[model samples]
Structure formats: C-alpha cells, structure tokens
Target: MTSPAVPRQPLLDDAIIALHAPTQAWSGRDGDIGDAAIDGIYHGDIRHIRSVRIRVADSSIETISRSIIDAATVEFGSVLRGLDDDGADPKVRLIRHRALSAGVMTEHLGLHSHRDVPLSVAVTVEVAPEFAPMQDVKAGLAATEPWHAEAIAASDGTPGRIEVRSSDGHRSFVVEAAGAAATVADTIVLRWDIELDPRSVVEIGWSATLTDDTLVVAAAANSEIAVPSTDDPRLARWVEQATRDLAALRLVLPDHPEDAFYAAGAPWFFTLFGRDSLWAARLALATDPGIAASTLRVLARLQGTKTDPATAEQPGKILHELRSAPLSLPNEGVHLPPLYYGTVDATPLWVCLLADARDAGMPEAEVRELVPALRAALTWITDFGSGTGSGFLDYVDETGHGLANQGWKDSGDSIQWRDGRLAEGPIALCEVQAYAYEAAVRGAQLLDDLGEGGGDELREWAAVLRDRFRDAFWVTTPEGRYPAIALDAHGAAVDSLTSNIGHLIGTGILDANEERACADLLLGASMSSGFGIRTLSLGAAGFWPLSYHGGSVWAHDTAVAVHGMLRSGLLAEAREVAGQLVDAAEGFAYRMPELHSGDSHDAVPFPTPYPASCRPQAWSAAAAIVCAEAYAAAP
Candidate 1:
C-alpha cells in the first residue's frame, strides 16, 4: 500500500488572534476575517463564523494602527479623511475594540468626528458563519457549501438577532447588534446609520454567542493564578505576556469543572492533551501548584482502563488527546480516536508531576485520594511500560494508523539516525528512560510518604534501569560522549546527538559527573543555537533550521533542559539557556510560539519564526514560568 502524502497546514505566522478558553478569533491585522486560510471565530473545535468584514458604505477608511490589548482583547484604529475637514490631519477616527470570552465575542465600534459640521455615516458589517469543524479548517478543507442564516425581528425594545445553525443542527450561534438593522443574504449584514454632531463620538456594539452541544472542555472556573514579577524588565515583560496567554488557555472538563488544565494551544489544539498538560503544569508549578493538582486529577479521570491497540490505550495509561470526534489526518497517516492513549512519556511524567506537586503544596488529603491511581500508574510502568521486552519504556504503533513516534516529538519523521534514516520501532527514546527512571524513584518516595509498600521495589527497579541506560544509550560523538536519541528495534543506539540527553540531568538516572558532561554538551555551540537548544545538533545529517523536530528550537524542549540544569546545580548553564529563550520570546513579542527556527543568532539578528507554528502553546507559554524561576533561583 502506498503511504498517504502529508498536506501542508495553513500558515498563521502573521494572523491576528484574540482568545479566551473555548473561544478564539483569527483575523487579518487590519481587523477583517474570511480571506486567510486560518481566519475564523472558533468555539469548541468548530468555526462558528468564517468571515466578518466592516465597511463604510460611502466613505473609504484606511486602517492606521492596530494594538493588542491582551490575549482576549484587541483594538484597531482607522481614519476616514474623506469624511473629515479639508486638512492635512485626518479629523475623523474609527476605532474597533474587540473582546472575547467563553463561547462569546463582542466588538465595540466607535466613530468620532472632530470636524466642525454634522456628519452622517453608514456602516455595514458583513458576517458569514460556516460552522466548519476545526480539523477541516486546519486541513485547509474549509466548508464552501451555502448555509442559511435566519434573521429574527427586533424584540421588545431590543435590536434584531441573527440565528445560524450547522447543517447537522449539532451547533449554533446567535448574533445580536445593538440599534442596527439586520438582514440575511449570502451573509448576515448589519447596518447602522448615525448622525454625529460636530466634535462628538458615537459607539455601537455587536456580540455573538456560539453553542456546541458536544463539548468535552469548558472555560476554567477558577481565577487566574498569581503571576510572579521580576526586577529585570525584559524577563518581567516576557512573564507578563506569557501569564496573560496562559490565563486565556485554561480549560476544564465539563464533567469535572473544578479541575482545570491549560489547553495545548490556539487555532488548533485548544483542548486537553496528556503530555502537553503534564509538562505545562510541571513548568508552571512555581506559579500555581493548585493547577498541578487539578491537572493530575483531570488526567487520572481519563486514565486508560484496558488494552486497545487501535486507540493505543493500556491499563493506567494517560490519554494522548481528547476531542469531541476522531482526529484523522490521512495525509500524515494519523487517525487517532477521540480518546487516544498513544503517548509513552505521559504516564511517567504524570508520576513525576505528582511527586513535584506534593512537594510544592498539594493538600495531604488530595494526595492520599490519588493513592489508588498512583498505584495503578506504577503498576502500568512495570507491566505494559517496560513489557516491550527491551528492558526499557518503549512504544511501537500496533495500528499503523496511529502515531509512529509516541515520544514528545510524535511526528513520523521525528526519530532519525545520524544518517537521517528513520529508526524502526519498538524504539526506546533516551529521554523517556530518564522520565521513567525519575518516575520510579519519585513514585517510591510518594509511596514511602504515604506508608505504602513496594517503595523499595520501585527504587530497585529505577536503579536497574539507570544502570542499563548508562551502559547502553551513551554514544561517543566528536565533541564528547552523550546519550543517543533512542535505541532502534535492533538495539543499536541511534547516534544522533540531540537535546534528549539534557533531560537525563537531574532525573536521578545519571551520576554527578555524567550530569555535568550532558549539561556541557547541551551548551556546546552545535546544540545551543543562541536562540535555544536545537532539537538536533548542527552536526547531524537530519538537521534543518526549520525541521519540525529534526532541528527546530522548541521553547518547552529547551525549558526542559533549563529545568534539569537548575536541578543538577549547573546554574550558569541554566542561565544561558534561559537567556536565549528570553531573547527568542522578545522576537515573538513575548508570546512564544510552539517552536521556532534553529537559525543561529550569529547568522540572523533574531530567531526566525517557524511560520506555521502554534502561538500561545501551553508548554511553550509555561516555559516562561520556568525561565522566570531559573532567573529567580540563580540570581
């Protein structure tokens, strides 16, 4: 059978975005939507409105400036010199302030006339609702078929409303415009006629509420966490911007509303993801340990309960992702079920995060309540996890349609040898072993704390894994010796000097000298791009500045190394990597994308953007917290 070809995802590097949990709007920088591939108002995995355009009926207005107020708000300034006094300076101004919240979006349009005479203006707003599923939109298969929108007559002393529903009737939205006449054609048009006195301003607003009957995630119930500030203005601004983005990314399971987790990212993954959530919570634990507690409980609720090859679920395993429907990307050969459990590290990382949360301040009763889950997860670590018979925690996609590489880099092209050949699975990643080793050691501590048995056995298991890893995974590169990216099915080390070895440093799987060696290797010029650590070293054949996993600089990936550098007492190394990330953050306006080009700062002035990268990514945004903590600790 021929393999399916991968389709290009829509580019969003320049799109303007406004977001709140369960709601996000994408538009052109000029404040118009419907033209770009990624432009839409999305609510709970579906795009409710595809196009929203505003025009002055008889006057030409030029957009002068745009400002992002916050993650959930934006303002656009336009000028209508045609309607202004005959002067060099434009006297007529139009400002559109847009704000978003859960399932709702509102835009306040203000028109100010500084002219000396009365002015009459006709403003027309056109809205088109496609009701396209997020997957289709992401795949660039947006809905083109005509859909009907009904205009409801103005009710007692209220403006008229436009009601739109999906063809299947599973989703709907209502649009209301204050003091405007609404009409339905191919698109819903709302028009307002205003007579403004000289030196006066008039403001009109419109709002929409989108509804989806089948939503697994909802807006978080708790308030935003307290953000830490710093004396360093650069670091403070990065943290502030990241904190705002993180606050907008919070989500909760509808069934358990009190437990909240950061959604993975915007425009695409705005829902629960196991590995993403675990790492994000771990990174942000310093800001709010409560989120870690909540994230643990949320994932535990969806813990795998049975062996299923199709969905990749096994007993006590955490799910890879949760969606209202199956996520099928045939071009990429991915057909994950709604509740897939394809991740290999999430289970171990879950254990690691649990221990960290306890140390940070999770309540004793809450920790005890999870003892049963904790035990089950530990059992899974030994049984299904290590049962690959490789004496390591490894993964192989039994269903060819599932993910090929189940590590943090789940891309099919992620795991490659030094020669750029894809490694065959059941492949064991170097970092996963570290995560499992840490999980075992940490799990034992948790058991001991709660007076549970098997603590000794768990530690012994970790010791054995650590010893095996020491002898088997390390490969000698020209620079020095470091752990290979993974061990292929033939048990040959995949000799690609990657950032994976950095994760070993403070995981208890490596000794003091070994940790120092790994830390130095990561800080080497080949691995450190002066923007952040490259996923693949520049010496590797697979290295491409923009390759998704081969050589791109992932903020979270670098933050993971920074985290370990701090834990391993490599303070200077940690500070260097943290500084690179802060510099990269500034290049992206402090809202770190999912990943960026590994282009060296020596070659380019700033880090180049991975054009299609997801902004406000959960772990990427949380990386700011890690950097902040590193600065606070090292300083």
Candidate 2:
C-alpha cells in the first residue's frame, strides 16, 4: 500500500450519525462545480452492511446547461490516417456534447486523444414536463424529441434548455427547470463524442423511473435513497461519497475532452480502464452488488480466451485492460498499445476475486459451475506463466506490447536485481506466486464443495504449490530474518524490505511460523507508517512517496495486509490498522482513492495525497469492506 500526505480538507465528522438523518447536510465544497461539480457523502451502515451509494446523478436540463456554462466551448478536431496505408488504426468517429450555462467556451481546447468520451461528463438534468418547455418532455423523451426548453424558478428567469449534440454539430434540446420533482417519467440524454473517425451516432437513449427516496434537488443532483439501495443505511454515506468522488477521477485525455475520464490525473481519467473497472466492480459489490456480479461476468465472458504465442493470451484468462481506439498505432511493429494485456496479476487475482465474490455473499456453487474456464486460467499460470518452470512465477511479455515487469510495480525497472539493478524477466515475484497459491487453494475449495470433478487433482495441485512455494521462496538469515522481495530468473534476491511483503495474505500456503514472521515484519516500526502502511518501507533505497508502485501507500494493499493480519489472529493489530485507515480516509475527505503518500510521520498532520491517482478506485473505494471484515473479526 502507498501512503501520500493527504491534502487538508474538512474531514467528515467523527461522531457517528443516526441512520435516518434526512437533513444530513452535505459537507465539502462543490468547489469545482462552477465548471461541473459532484458531491458524495458516506452514509455509514446502510441496513447494517459495508456498502455505500453516491447521490450525484444530475438529470435536469437546467442543471446540465449550467454545467455546460462552466465550459466555454469544446472543439472536436480529429485526424485519421487511412488504415495500413501509413500507420493508421482508423475507425469511425462522432462527437456531440452539451454546453454549460455561462462560463468559458470549450472551443479553445480541442479533444486530446483517442479515448472514448464517458457518461460522467454530461450535465445531469431532469426532463420533466414542467421543467421542460411546453412540448411534452415525456413524448419527446420516449419518441425521440431530441430537443426541449423551459423557463422556470420564479428566481432565475433565465430558461434552461437541454441540448443534445448531434454527430454533425447540430444541437437539439428541450428546455426544463433543473431538479423539478419528476412528476412524469423522463429520459436523460448522454452525448457520446465518438472520437474515432467514421464514428457514427448510434444514439443512446435511457429513461429511469424515480422513486420517492430519489430526491430531485435543484441545488445538487439525483441520488438514490440510502437505506433501500445498499441494504445497510450506515453505508449510504460512503456509497454516496464514492459515487460523487468518481468525478474527481475524471480527466480530459488530451485529444479526448468533452468526455469524462477515470484516468491518472484530475480533469481527465474518466474512460473505463480495465483495472479501474475491476476495482469499481469490487466496491460496487458492496452497494450495487449487481454491478459487481455483472462486471465479473462481463470480464470473464470477454476474457482473452485464446492461447497464442503472438498475443500472450491464455485460454479463459481475464484481460488486464481494453480500449476502443481507431487511431491507435499498429501493434505488429510498434510500441503502441490499443489494449494491453501485460498484467500477470489480474489473471490469478481474478480467479481469487471470483471465488471471493461467493464468500462476500455471492453463490460459490454458481461460480463453481464455470469450472472449465477456471481450469484454463490455472493452466495459463502454471504453464505459460512459469515460462521456465522453476516453481516460481515470471512474466516476460511474449508479445512485447504488454508491460515489462507485469506485476503491480508494472513500470520498467520495477523488478530489480539484488544490487538494485533491474532484474530481467521471466522474473518471478513472491506476490504472484502467492496469488497463484491462493487462487489454486480457493479454486479447489470451490470445486470440492460444489461436487466438481478432479477435486482430488485440485487439492493435489494446491499441495504441490504449497510445498514448492515454502521451499523456494523462504530464506532465513542469522538474525532469523528472511529476504522480503523474491528473486527474478537470475536467482538473485530483489530484496526491498517493504510492505509488498504484506501481499501474501489469503495464500493459505504460509504456515503458522511463516505467517507469524511476516506479520511481525508488517506491524514492525519500519514497515508501518503513521498513515496506514507504506508500500516500501521509509528507509528502502528505492522508497519515494510519489514513485508509482514502490513507495506510495496504497489503501487497497494495506487493507489486504490488515485482512492478512486478522487472518493470522492478530485481532488487536488489525483493528488498529483499520481504524487508522478510516482515520486516514477522513483526511482525504473520507473517500479512499488508489493511494496517498507517507513522506514523513511529522509532516503536518496528514498523509499527503498523491497529486491525482485515480480517486474512488475500486479497491480503494472498497477498502471499507475489507476494513469492515477485519473490524468484525477484531478482538
């Protein structure tokens, strides 16, 4: 886990609020809303569950236009080279978006990249008849009115019209007051700016029925009623906050403005990155468990199901990431990546997650029915993943389009030689081996319990993994300390004594002694930070708060480690860490993003937030669930 110093913001009150505070005044500034803002608050304990739902769905034409007002003007200037002619991955492209009520003109800033525009960037507006112009908003909404307008709010005599941008630059809309109680069923139009050339407008029309709990606030946006949404009312605040925080992660990839992003820096990352999707699914499982189930099914169903040396894909392996880009460079002779499958961790981790879904309350029996697919993934790991079967795992991208290290420290030089020189792949890292061991053990459990065939074989395979892993990975020093990070194919230890050591939780392969040793290392003074735990300990040579993977304090990773500690019966320790994390979250406005930095314990009161890591990341957002598990198990 990486911990960056958190920016000082008004933290959520520490006092526990009753579940039914209807007027739980939403805190925090919609500071950025002058452009388009979203605000989500954590409603702890929604029906006594570890889940949260955000209340930031804007569906008012006035609100939408007001959002657009923040935007001066937006230009869609696209360039497409004919495919295979001279480096062109040319495809269709079309772009249409709403303009804000009154601020800057978006025309100055052109679309940046090839990433698709997202749904979050749209101005959320209500299309009710009263809100909309005299024209029937419902009929127009149902039968494709494409345009409407309304003048309301005895206050702001200025009327608001919902404009739907056509691919050809035509704008049509129905005017309506922002946030008028939905007296009639309405549809919200989200403009899809097709960045890929030849992009045709396959109009996406969607209408949602509003329930009583669904508040239509003109001041804010539409958010689902807390209790009924996620089962536990306590979780509503967090869920709402997580949903609103999703906007914080939105970025306008250079060639791709006018669309919401879910990328690295703020004002951009709104596109659906595969990793982000997986994380969102995990957290959504708590609130919108349906999303979690569907995300898994979707990813698994669309998983790279072929094993070809050229693509580095194994049958039934879930992909690391995917993108729909026509302007992307050709992969055969270039470093360009339309969609890269370089991550070695996603596969085994996916299996474990599927298995975990059941434990978190999904039906294991049902997940087990996908036996053949699971077996295919297991094969990919032991066979192709091993590359050179030393019982350890290593990934040298066969296609070279994928990542270099392939694990979380996926950046180049991520995996290193003992002397701090980068290690060459087929490099086997300890965590990957742990993931393999955990997945196999859990997979076998799912199989055996479900009366699946080869239960014996499954157990046997897991046993072999356990035997080899303990033998090959552990090294005892004179002071009774073994190396932390594992070695690459070269047999040299890539020892960087840090919290990557904590990733071994749930492997079930660590014996009591090894578990105890690892736990000691984790809770030790050097490894643990004031703000949760650091990715790499503070003293390691490679340690840096901002370093992508090596040193930042990631919430999800630490949550996993805390769970690992709880698993080993260190209840008090687990509770402390979990509490600290919740406390740390308060500093970051109570919503955990990918990570923060822990530069110094004394550094002015809080962990400095990583400038713009993906906020509301799935695992980070879902850390509360993990924390809840540890909390429930704590002594």
TM-score of each: 0.98, 0.61
Q: Write the per-residue lDDT of candidate 2 for residues 1-635, one digit (tens) a residue.
A: 89975323222222111111111111122211111111111111001011111112232111111121111112122322211123355332222222221111111111222434322222222222211111111112211223233323434554232333222222222323332232223443223222223322333222211111221111112222122234333334454554444323333222323222233211112233445555444433444454444446545655677665554566656666543321122222224243455667767776776776777677665575566667777777666567676766677876555566667666675554323566666777788777888877777777777776655675677789778766666755322364446666676666666566677854687776777787677666666766677776655666677766666778877877776777677777777777667767777666665678766555648777775454445467656665665656775
Candidate 1 regions with alpha-carbon error over 4 angstroms: 1-7, 153-159
> What's model 2's lDDT at 559?
76
**Candidate 1 collision pairs:** none
| lDDT of model 2 at position 391 | 64
* Top candidate when judged by lDDT against the true structure: 1
Error of model 2, residue 281, in angstroms = 4.6
**lDDT on C-alpha atoms for all candidate structures:** 0.90, 0.48
Positional deviation of residue 298's Cα in model 1 after best superposition, in angstroms? 0.6
